[model samples]
Target: MTQATLSADRSDANANANAGAAAGALRRIGAHLAPWLAPLAILLAWEFAARSGVLSTRVLPEPLAVVKAAWSLIQSGEMWADVKVSTWRAVSGFTIGGGIGLVLGLATGLFKPAEIALDSTVQMVRNIPALAMIPLVILWFGIEEQAKVFLVALGVFFPIYVNTFHGVRSVDANLGRARKARRRRRPARHPHHVSGRASAAVEERAAKRDARPRPQCPRRCARRAR
Candidate 1:
């Protein structure tokens, strides 16, 4: 082929590759953005409704108004201070309550006797609404920082306890059976058999399994697929 013709063909091939890449990238971007469409539509409708005088600004402000207020707070430094205080409170309460819940959850999950003894009492406490405790809490703790922290801790406790308990309970029966079968097949684990490489492999497998996305409900899966 002539040099000019060869160069033209090479340029055409490069252009085609670039166009293909750009089209693929756009498709990927659209796929990522598809889920956000519903929320964006809702926001637009809300702003339009507020602007059209159908909704009172006092009762339900415009989305833009809310954004402006947030920006104002950010400029005034109040937002940062509020965030700092709330974060400190949440972390303090969560740490204290979650620590206790973890201990209790493990104890109850592992021991049937502990579950029988403590589970009923914990369930009863959980049944009582946090709002109902306000008067009693005020009477005893007198609306101090301790009372606020206690309320936050109480709010934080139940979810942590429930999840921890379920997580311990969710240990696969098949895994236990498999372990027993292996033990029976080889009555003793030799030092060579229990090598660092084998242990590391098991741990890495576990980490990857844990990192994998969990199965969603049928409806959610369908929605996401769309």
Candidate 2:
């Protein structure tokens, strides 16, 4: 081929390769972004529909109005206070209830005799819905904040108690057996996995040996085989 012609062909090939790479990259980006497209389209449609009077503007305010109201609440600091108080209540209840449940559950769960003794009563209490107990709780603890906290704790305790009791009672025997087997196998553990690798090395060595011709078998064994 002529030098200039060869150079022109190489430049054409390089340009095609760059274009193909760019197309591949664009396809990958589209694949990654595909999931968000439907949600964004729906949101846009909903906003336009609400604004265009196809939907009730009062009930389904435009996204802009919702954003404005949220911004106003934030500027006035009501949103922050509300978030703080609610978060405090939730975290307090979770900590108190979760701790109480874990301790009681572990006690009942770890002991079979205790499980038999306490399981029925706890299960009965759990069957009664928390909302139903509100009246009784109000009468006993009043409407003070402690009443709410106690209710939250009680709400979390029963499921943990019953589940823990049953879990300990019904644990698999094979797990214990497996633990014992592991203890027995602890020695020479290196040999277990390494044996396979060692066998692979031996096979490779045998392949190398077989590649070359070997001396013939002894006459007596060869005759018997024949």
lDDT of each residue in 109-142, candidate 2, tens digit only: 7776766787678778888978899999999989
Report how far off residue 20 is in candidate 1 (Å): 3.7
Q: How close to the true structure is residue 172 of candidate 2, measured as C-alpha lDDT?
A: 89
Runs of candidate 2 with Cα error greater than 4 angstroms are 117-226
| Residue 162 shift from truth in candidate 2, angstroms | 7.8
Among the numbered candidates, top TM-score falls to: 1
Tell me the TM-score of model 2: 0.55
lDDT of 1 by residue, 1-226 (tens): 8999999999999999999999999999999999999999999999999999988999999999999999999999999999998888888888888888999999998889999999899989999999999999999899777787788889888888888888988988799899889987784656557796799999999999999999769998889999
Local error of candidate 1 at 61, Å?
Answer: 0.9
Clashing pairs in 2: none
Candidate 2, residue 110: Cα displacement in angstroms equals 3.0
User: Model 1 — TM-score against the truth?
Assistant: 0.64
What is the TM-score of each predicted model, taking all chains together? 0.64, 0.55
Clashes of 2: 0
